[model samples]
Target: MAATNNQDLESKIATEVGHADVYDEKAAISDFKADAIEAENAEHNMTVLQAVRAYPMASFWAFVMSCTIIMESYDVFLMGNFVALPAFRNKFGVPYPGHKDYIIETKWQQALQVSGQLGALIGVFLAGPLTSRIGYRWATLTGLMLLNIFIFSMYYAESLPVMFVSQLLEGVPWGIFIANAPAYCSEIVPIQLRAPCTQMLQMFWAIGSIIVNGVAYNYNSLDSDIAYKVPIALQWMFPTPLMVLIFLAPESPWWLTRKGRFEDAAKAVERLGRKSAVNSTETVSMMRRVIDMEKSVKKPNHLELFKGTDLRRTLIVCGVYAAQNLTGNLIANQAVYFFQQAGVDNELAFALGLITSALQMVFVMLSWILTTYYGRRDIYLWGSFANFVLLIALGIAGSTGTNNAASLAQASLGLIVSVLFTLGPAPASWVIIGETSAIRLRPLTTGMGRATYYIVEIPCIFLASYMLNPTGGNLGGKCGYVWGGTAFICLAVAWWGLPEMKDRSYREIDIMFKRKIPAREWKKTEIDVNDDE
Candidate 1:
């Protein structure tokens, strides 16, 4: 009698959630949403490492997928060093005596870098429809092909205007690639591996930055234009092989389900792993269940992103990524420039830049190991707290004047902040965004989240430029106060707003949101995936 009563209660909840019968599409969609607990239980049953060992091909392909963002990293680090190089700056910049050779006029420096960001913003917006319509493989191929072409143009350019145009065009591919890569990784992999796999993209990005820094450190002093052009041309090496690999990659099963090609979706899953513990039948049914449930709720649209509980998620994701920008990241991004602006020479600045990149790469690797063992929210909060203290110290050091002691203090502070950021906010931001959105609108929401993030960063970018430039505000290390305040706000947001989602599947996340559980409570809440009611 008790079991019968429990079944009745569960049936009522299913009906309220829009449960339908197995053969009927309406019944399937409704029933799946109503009973998402079972699916969630199945999805997250295995540990991430176990999942990887069970399906090696999935892990291999995810590694390949992570490589897609190397260009963005390559562009940022290479450009940072470019502005510091005398040979390249001499071609388009006004000569300055106190500085190394020349400084690109403050306005042009802002425009050249902002142009890439603006183009990236546009590319992210376009990526949603492009990937949705053409599929992930083709969309990625399109971006990679176009990115290589733009790099060639930038390399051959003779004037500032031509170079600026190339940079803007160059950002389009990067934007598209960035928006899609995380979504692709999330969709293709199992739930346990989702956060770590998405984060591997950041690791690849760090590797790219390390490579560019090494190249610039060695080649920046060359006598001819070849010095700059060689680094730009080096970007050409990544796309061709990526293009070939992506051609052989399987289409996302979720994408196939979105198109109602259930058979093809099953085949794609089979291709991902033929004899894994998660056989094709079980995985395909789960996909259909969740996919149909989402369709019953609504189409995957950006407007729905702001509706009800989803609004909480959108804000959290947007805040985390935006905080990533505001939390003194630009300082690290423009390290070579900021280091030179202080008392450091160009050679040491380049060397320090290389060290910063290498440390971040190491920390990123550490983040991978740590993320496997820790929760995202804790790492993010702890990291924010550390930055708050470090940035305050940085500001205090800068206020002491530019004596040798103060300069050394400021440089030491910058290096420390670099390590803390990679461990905390840098890797955490991307992982949180990857897990925050609903699976159906994952691409649209991720794109929207990143696009808004870059928008907030535009003003921050301008501020970093003004303070770092000699002829401008020239605040140098003192600019730490401004970003320090923002980091404090980010810390508070992490404490109050960020939820703990270490190993929760999308279904569990949905259930939690539906119950309106407080962010802080998520770590301790025991979700009963097999509950009858």
Candidate 2:
């Protein structure tokens, strides 16, 4: 009787548990699917985060490479201060007129500037082929060589024509260096920190400008010929040390992968990652993915920039960069003259040049901090908005015909606006350029962007001469119009065209147009690869 009861109870319990097992299994399947999706998402997030974390190290070396290039920007702008001084023009037999009219306002000076741009035009075209053939490392070295040769030659260049030729040759390297540096920085830096790293280079360029300005200011006061010659000759100093250092620096692993040198590329990636001699499966996998992607896509030409999805992006890049050049900053390469027009003494003008350069560095640092913490869009928008307000204030101040305290206040406001100009769009423009384009298209896109920059700058520089000419009507008001017009355009572009790329991965940005995500929704939108599949 006991065994019969036990068997009956066991049978009942088994029947109940059998139904429970079916329910449990169904639940488990659902959980497993959800978990798989979560795991993939987590894995993707980790991959992107890792890339972000790895950016600083890679960008540090690239920053060092950039120092070499920034020296060129220094040389370009330093002329503004030096040309205003008696030392440079007098020694070189170039005439130095009063403040509103100086050697820089002359036909020869205009030619020199134009020649540099002409060389840049050619150099931009040459950079792709040269970099493609010799690799970025050697291409940079070639640029350094050209820069050094020109710098050393500038010391002995007796006539305007000779100086023009030297400046023209200098543009080749300048174009090559600027063109390739962005791609180099972009390739080596992780996507998350790409904006900051590239912007850091711009900051350094500003720092270079400061250093050159300060040095030129000091040399300007000196009576010796060596004052100008020494500073100009020092141009060779940065490149040699940079070349030696970069000789040990790892070449871009992406470039290596492009050339089909997988083993060498692997080694470079290892060095970039600061890993031991062991093989990196992750690096290899990324390399393979990149190579495969390159193989699958059709390469775009310059004309393609105006058609298809690329057209919108190209236009924005062009507009932003053009605005950057047109905003009177590069034109402010003639800052010394502007100061003199403001009735500042020559010594004070040089002093102010140094101060302005230093202040720009400070603002750029603030910009970097804001960029890292605040969103790119906010900084860009606020920058333009503030600039617009300041420009309007300047216009009002100029219109009042007041040279008293009110005039000084307006001038101060203008300087502040210029500082904001540096802090805001100047650095932001490059970051946007780096972030928006695909890696394969970076060179062409940056080339076009820079081409727009120079093209716009050439005309602006010429126009500035006409507007600020003492003989012209109401020079201050005319200059105000230029600034005011630029400020308005920047405001409009920031409002409508500029995309918010902050915290978004390059892959996400790559899908921006394809998915047609609005700029405001960029950060909040989750890119769904499965939908395309």
lDDT of 2 by residue, 155-194 (tens): 7887778877877787888888777777787677554556
Q: Looking at candidate 1, what is the lDDT of residue 31?
A: 65
Candidate 1's TM-score: 0.91
lDDT of all predictions, in order shown?
0.81, 0.67
Query: Candidate 1: misplaced stretches above 4 Å?
Result: 1-43, 97-100, 274-276, 530-533
lDDT of 1 by residue, 362-392 (tens): 8888887677678788888888888988988
Best candidate according to TM-score: 1
Pick out the ten consecutive residues of candidate 2 with the lowest summed lDDT.
35-44
| Number of colliding residue pairs in each model | 6, 0
